[model samples]
Target: MKYPSLKNYINGQFVASNSARTIKVVSPVDGALLSEVTMSSAEDLNDAVEAARIAFHKWSKTPIKERVQVFFRYKFLLEKNLQELATICSEENGKTMSEAIAEIEKCIELTEFATSLPQIVTGEVLEVSKGIECRTEHVPLGVVASIVPFNFPSMVPNWTIPNAIALGNCMILKPSEKVPVSSGRIAELLKEAGLPDGVFNIVHGDIEIVEAICDHPGIEAVSFVGSTKVAKLVYQRATNNYKRCLALGGAKNHLMVMPDAIATMTAQNVVASMSGCAGQRCMAASAMVGVGPIDHIIDKICDEARKVVPGENLGAVINKESKDRIEKYITEAEQQGAKILVDGRGAKVDGKGGGTYVGPTVIDHVTPDMAVAKEEIFGPVISIMRTNTVDEALAIENANPYGNAASVFTQNGGVARYIIERASAGMIGVNVGVPVPREPFSFGGWNESRFGVGDITGKSSIEFWTKLKKSTIKWNPEAGVNWMS
Candidate 1:
């Protein structure tokens, strides 16, 4: 399938970048050449920032009722083009069709959430003293930007776009060069949804563009989702420039299986957690702890993992480099004495000879000292560790530096509670593998998984995207009333 010409969307128009350097967008599904994205220059980023700056004046003043109307229309247009977006997402990112559709569905859900800003964005009013009242209002920041990762082209960009724009802030988005096609489609849909010109823009590039976004004086705030190393850099640079920033980083999420866990359910959820999206997601579970005697459940997990075929059940990793990196981890773990219960090396789809496929891999008896048990593989691989007690399991979880998410599977509420309260991750689950919070609950992590304050979604997003403006008023001073008199 031929894709639309990849170009920078600045000032509401699809324009070619000033930079001559370009990168080919290859489909991870079959290694087909999808498109060539221009490596947007610093000048191109300037154009986008300028466009957002220009739009912010009118957009920020636009009534909240009117601002939400655009999101309402966007939600409809996203639903209308759901299938096309999903196909683009799956082809470029190498997730399954179902997962791609689910990502777009998440985008739609966030758009729906954005529409509720009219009701939820209200301020507070209280009487501080007699005849004196103070009130606070949520006000939009002028020009803001979001730097989204490649894993979820639609969902991650939507994470900031909906809330930022709905709160009346104009936005410039820098999408990962790997999966730029879906973002172009999103730009078109937002335009169709009646979003005003320059209200939202897309600039495509590599590190240069990222540095530009971080340093651009016109941009008031920045949101980022990527590796912890890069996330920290972006956060420091953006905040150094005195812009509000939230940078979500990498994770090595863990899942604990207690002795009382239902074998079938635990196996299903554990496999799904590690293998979903080829384990490209930050929320994907990479480590599993078997507390007490759960060898029976571990055997079931291995069986389920073996059943996951590359093309049928599991999807390819982002590229050949990612595939090689994931396999290296598996090989190193095996050499370090960890057992490869279900090896995924050399897995492939018959017709997709060039696809970067890696089947579901499980490494058992992975000690904390092993590199595989420590680093983020960012692939469909699971490292299993055994512990004799729940404290040991919780200790393993807490010791890990990345605290994005942790889950425990047990019928016992006390065990679940103990883990939930002690787990260092910001998101916790009982019997749920992926514990991404639903709408209005906020999504974020503690420690290395996240940087800056507040979350990137739900109610927390409103705060990240907007500023609080408080007004204290006294129409007439009452004589000797409180200290103000």
Candidate 2:
């Protein structure tokens, strides 16, 4: 039970900030204070940014092969300390040990994919018209700020920081206030793995520090993951300052049960998607669009959902306010004529735990106007709607304002092909529940669920880290500015 008292990581060292204040990291399972992380204010943020700026010139000029070596070393260190780090994730984030481990594994996969970034951050050699050959090169954005969310502290940071760093850039991390300890451990591991100072810096604060990052002139770009409202604000503010931004916003994922889909398989996938992480995932299948076996599938999904008991250590919503809001949403939905079909609501949670627990509340007869269906509850509540035809299901999927990810379970290849083409979301799963963590593939949302042009974890991650300058090099071995003229 000996956990390190966390401090902000700056200039390759863990240091106490000017404020010297700490935010106690609490276990959502029992509300017990697990660890204390040093709280960084605007001053600390400025310090980290300044450090990254100072280190940027040297780090970005380093050889790509040498950079790859550091990433390899970091990967090794993570493997060595996987259990300890994952424990911190589970303790603070309240995910099950298994889920936490999987989260770490996914991050490891991303790191492995990013290992080739040194080489894969490649340039293109092109043959244009006549003897004039054109070439394009990829270069790093100077100082980037990555704002990570609480749900996947370690995993998302892998998405945010690795590609940026691999491309010879200095990255400043604004990890979730709820789980900064996990990120502190990551910073510690990266240092052990031999990254240079200022190349990786951690600044901790709520929204104030994040806003400062969005507007910081010294910062060249920003990457973010959070709610849609915040994502839009961050993207707008950053782009307004002429900065590169990759903002992943909120999601209202849909799971469609096509008639051709096997009933039992659909039920299993739905349960895994909705119940896993206690439905706290942004990509969790919150809305079920019923088709093929519309009525029959809802019954199966509801039955499987009923068995998902609210238990201690299963994890709670982030905090008390989150818990209250989720519960209120369920009640309001019920009042709005959505039937509270089955109760997964855990009883009075022990205050020793975060007391932010909401049991799985399943609602049927849900309408578009109902709170449960309309709002992204960010809890273990599932809403079921029946659509008779495939077109109707696809229509329901598209009608949602937030379009992060969507899935259709079907055996018919034609139907699968049609829905995937028609469904308007970033990630789609034909028979899969959650189609996240597919490394080397771009993951993003359309509509309100995402902002900015670059997606993370796929082809877009590479695009996000590097900038392309279309060099129309009209070569006469002569003038440079004259080419533009």
TM-score of each: 0.98, 0.93
Which has the greatest lDDT?
1
Best by TM-score: 1
Segments in model 2 whose C-alpha atoms lie over 4 Å from true places: 1-5, 20-22, 127-132, 348-355, 469-485
Among all windows of ten consecutive residues in candidate 2, which has the lowest summed lDDT? 476-485
Candidate 1: segments with Cα more than 4 A from true spot: 477-482
Kindly list the per-residue Cα lDDT of model 2 for residues 294-393, writing each as its tens digit.
6677778778776765554355666676777787888887877888877755445544444466776678888766767767888887888776788888
Instruction: Quote the RMSD, in angstroms, for model 1.
Output: 1.2
Give one clash count per candidate, in the order shown.
0, 11
Residues 1-29, model 1: lDDT tens digits: 36765999998899999989988999998
